[model samples]
Target: MSEVQQARPTLLYVDDEDMARKYFARAVGSEYEVLLAASAEEAIATLATDGARIAVLVTDFRMPGRDGGELLREVAQLYPQIVRILVTAYADKDMLLQTVNSGEVFRILEKPLSVAQVREVLRLAGERHRERALRQHRLMAIDETLAFLAHELNTPLAAIANFARGIESRVAGEYTEQRQGEIGQAASAMHDNAQYCLAVLSSFLQSVRNSAGSKAARPEPGAEVSAGALVASLLDTYPFSGDQRQWVQVEMHGDFPVQTLPNCVALVLSSVMSNALRALAGTPSPALRFVVVAQPHLEIHISDNGPGIPPEVMERLLVDPVTTHASAGGSGLGMIFCNRVMQSFGGGIRIASASGAGTTVTLDFPSFKNRMIRSDR
Candidate 1:
């Protein structure tokens, strides 16, 4: 390997002045791998070369063609990990200030620059670049894992739900009353749990796909949706019977108000409520409650008065990549998906519960812009 490859770090210097470029190369060459480019175009071309690690960019404010400010803007947008530094003369004070205000350049070194001062700035900039690269790598890894795991898990989960529904129907229709009840209950429970898993898996998959590439398709900017109506529609279509409804008391609190960004908010709320409904078993006073507070943000709080998240499993509920620490009934994908959905829409969820104090998950999505909405009778 060349000495530059095994050296401390590499600095890319872009300037039109051959004398200044030679001077800079000599000043910093011993301590660093100085890649000299006479113009912004050459700097970009050099940056594109394979295995060319340009930690810090030092470019003159005034170049023959594209100036440092213009070149740094493109670099920041494209390879944001590379730190940008503008070198300006005493005459270019106005241009330097303009570049700084535009947030294009990280720092500006005026002419008559000392070697030691330039070295210090380059050191700091290189460190910042490395930190940013690390963060980007981590985010990329998370997105990839989300896609693979969610897609792989969805197939088996769908099959389990289908078979459970089939068994439930056969038992309920053909089996003896005594045995049918037991078999029917088991199948129903399995189907509900599987459906819950599917919802969680699908939500995560959607969020990852959305974040990985283009922006998520936003719903129409302005549309009033009745929260109450949305809830009623889903409840009517959801495959649940009167007996199941009787087993759990479902309460929709507050005079429901119309909210903007309604679809995204509603989908998250419904998923959380559905998960709560599934967890409403093997506990006294099995009930799922929804309390919608319309304020700064459209707040939807769903709570279940079940055994609540156990101390051992509560922390792992939504934090882990795959949370299997939930109750033995359903897959823990529900909370994971819910959290990701909240985060994607510039929203988030807050968890509140003690060991027996029934878990409450609150979702807060952006509210309607400058529009006052009243509850419809």
Candidate 2:
């Protein structure tokens, strides 16, 4: 294909009527490479094959099998990057409002769809798609930089602390014993400070990667650790502010092994826990609960008693995310990255919240058939 052909963004138009499909394909073929599907099923199949090339999905709402609203919902959940538009002949105000809000659709085009309207909608959608692509590229670049910083600083920092210990040990003698002991304590403090700094850096960097990383490679399943141990490690390592540690209550219903890297799990938990903590801020009698369950499948529930998420904002967390605190440099990538991690591990994450009721985030791990029970060490 020529550069011009490749430059033109692709748009998928779904309609049950044959004439309508042809009309749309003919109408907007000049600006966008139009792909047509007869029904929701055919549209899904086309996306399965050509989704990477497609930027916009425009569908006729009334159809035989699955309606356009249903397809839009599915696409929003699965391929969130693709922009969605609903073209309906009969627009029920309530239904349209609900569908558009829930799906985070780009636009709603009423039937008798004019060529001008279609062109304008596609133009806007194309612009949005391009902007998102650029933003995603930038986020990935930032993540690469963070990774490099972490890699370069970690080893040398550890070596410096180790060398400090040796220096403290070598200066020990009868005259210098007291001085050497004080020096040794200083070395220990240095090590602790360095380690603490590294831990905080890792947590902050990991949080960004969790939200910004669009395409992180899946690592092979690593060694397993007990849920209790994992949770304890997370809570222990997490840097809590004065009196914030007192707010958390950890409970273990049952213990089971989780087959995933501890760091990956910790990062995922950190993102959600960060969100919960932000919500809990300034709330009276703020409470944070971390619970583990080892039943049909291992589950970690992080619940906070705070002002709950709004309906529109909660819906967008997975479908179309935007951080509640943009002024505070929130990227709104938390749930998206978390969901990707869960999917990578053949598991899933569930977020349940209401307006007045607090939010609960549940990380659901897939079950493994080979089960081993280990006595506590």
Best by TM-score: 2
| Model 2 lDDT tens row, 203-289 | 645544434422322111222356676667666767665577788889988876654444466667777776777678789999999
Q: What are the runs in model 2 whose C-alpha is more than 4 Å off?
A: 1-6, 174-178, 200-377
Candidate 1 residue-wise lDDT at 232? 51
Candidate 2's C-alpha lDDT? 0.74
- Candidate 1 weakest ten by summed lDDT: 368-377
Q: Tell me the TM-score of model 2.
A: 0.58
Local lDDT at 107 for model 2:
95
Residue 231, candidate 1: how far off, in angstroms?
24
